[model samples]
Target: MVTPAGTLALLHTSPVHVPVFDGLRDRYHPGLVLRHLVDEELLRRARSSGSDAVAGPVAAALAAAVADGADAVLCTCSTIGGTAERQAGALGVPVLRVDRPMAAEAARYRRVVVVAALRSTLEPTVSLIAEESGPEPSFVSTVVVEGAWELFEAGDRDGYLDAVAASVDRAPLSEDSVVVLAQASMADAVERMSTRRPVLASPRLGLAAAAEAVAASAAVRAGRD
Candidate 1:
């Protein structure tokens, strides 16, 4: 009657991510336990020093946290895939980089456009996703929304999502193609967009997959016991 699920630790760059994970946890299992590690300063430095500079430290921090007891580590930032993978490799634990699932999903479509709030966040993610795609989608591109981050920082959260939604609305989203939102913050607006094209957010995909992984791991462990 009792199911023993493992711990899932989410490492994020800001407090904004907490809500997303909480939503996932509530839906997946009432008993599912979750934890967080926020590196706001690293994010601040990344803003000026570039996304790559912050990746190493953030991933290393997450690795240490997982090694202590966490069953899995999920990196919420889409901009630091390389660093996260490196850290995941070193830890030898299940590290779910958020974008991989979305990227894999996007590969199912012919043309895919990734909408991102920051240029620094877009390039690396687009590259990594494109590389994972193998065949290279017809158009793997980014639509950058300038100043959305400032609105978020200024406590205009709705404005930020509205602005992002407006940008997504304006995009020439193809009916047959898929649209992926490159940031976790962008995940909130997918339902608001009335696009014929599919909109994928890495965090949602990652969290859903992580929940399943947690369930499967628990089942396997129970059998072994």
Candidate 2:
């Protein structure tokens, strides 16, 4: 009998990520079961008060996802993603931040340009990339896609993507600098970029990592049985 793919849950700060990750699952991990949970308020609170404000809630969400049959949980909110990943040991499951894979790849270069639409996302992303880069990591610069978040919040997705793409074009990138798009929503901006530079985004890369994690965990469970 074929071993079934384990279920993966995605925690999102905005509802828009639901379709994006779902599309990724369909494209790559067709057999993987997926559950999506969104809490717009978690991000809202983190942006206002700080990431600590949502630490407890992020933990609760991860636990709830596990209890609900998720073998792995992927947090899609860049703002509070670090807090969520820290709960992985307590959850005893793979709780991953979506930016992590992209961060790991971005950290390889001598210079990196991280682009985000919100100030709240910028710091967490930089921290994640820095951790991946180690002590002597690359020189990382940040670019905020000004006026883009408002467009996203206003449901102007096309405009928001265009703005993100425009920011990449305007960024001061050297030939060696790899560009990292800080949010999953910014993935499409890569295709929209005119600059011939390597751009990394979270959605596809993150989901692939999550799928690998699920497969690894499942193999272990199967071994035990």
Candidate 3:
């Protein structure tokens, strides 16, 4: 697949993500052209079955993006992120896990808190933190905010944000601990919190990394040509 320069395709599991990621692209990577492909069923399957069950869909999405002339692909759903990255190499384009950069940042802190609205995201997020943290171990705690996803699904954005924020506030976080919002949608909630601890959110960091990856891929291809 011959991808055009400065083109980024995001494979999202929900249509709700299009605006969120499009906004991030506009703010962080304004020069790059952004495209979105949504599969609403992917997340439901991932949550109910497993990430491996959605591997085929993830690979298909990546291939479709590359076929559509995307220089790189971003998997916006953390639930399917591992599968997307695993298949990235075969697609001939960068496929980035949205929480990777946030995981890297969280790994730097001695104590870390990972908060998620879905149970499926916890393991992948913790695994990413472990991978990024290297040989050294960090104290990582996880919190799954109850009712947050329901509120989000019901279109009660404020209710969802409040639930997440309240969960973060109730977490056993120290002043030195860094909090990580495990899902991109939780970013807004973290921003609204009054905690003194540093909070890491995936969207901005992930998109920045995606932009860099795309630019590097473009440069490499240009040199090769």
CA displacement after TM-score superposition, residue 100 of candidate 3 (Å): 0.4
| Pairs of residues at least 3 apart in sequence or in different chains that clash in candidate 3 | none
Q: After superposition, how far is residue 98 of candidate 2 from its true place, in Å?
A: 0.5
Candidate 1: TM-score? 0.88
What lDDT tens digits, residue by residue, belong to model 1 across residues 1-225? 222467778878779899888876776555667788887777677768876787668767876877666767777877665567567666756777778788888877778888888777877677766776765455676798878888988988898898888888889866677888888888988878777677888876787766666666556656878
lDDT of residue 52 for candidate 3: 91
**Clashing residue pairs, backbone N/CA/C < 3 A, model 1:** none
Question: What total of clashing residue pairs does each candidate reach?
Answer: 0, 0, 0
* Candidate 2 weakest ten by summed lDDT: 1-10
**lDDT score, candidate 3:** 0.87
> With candidate 1 superimposed using the best TM-score fit, by how many Å does residue 180's alpha carbon deviate from the native?
0.7
Q: Considering TM-score, where higher is better, how would the candidates rank from best to worst?
A: 2, 3, 1
- Candidate number with greatest lDDT: 2
Q: Which candidate comes out best when scored by TM-score? A: 2
Q: Rank the candidates by lDDT, best first.
A: 2, 3, 1
Give stretches of model 1 more than 4 Å off: 1-4, 215-225
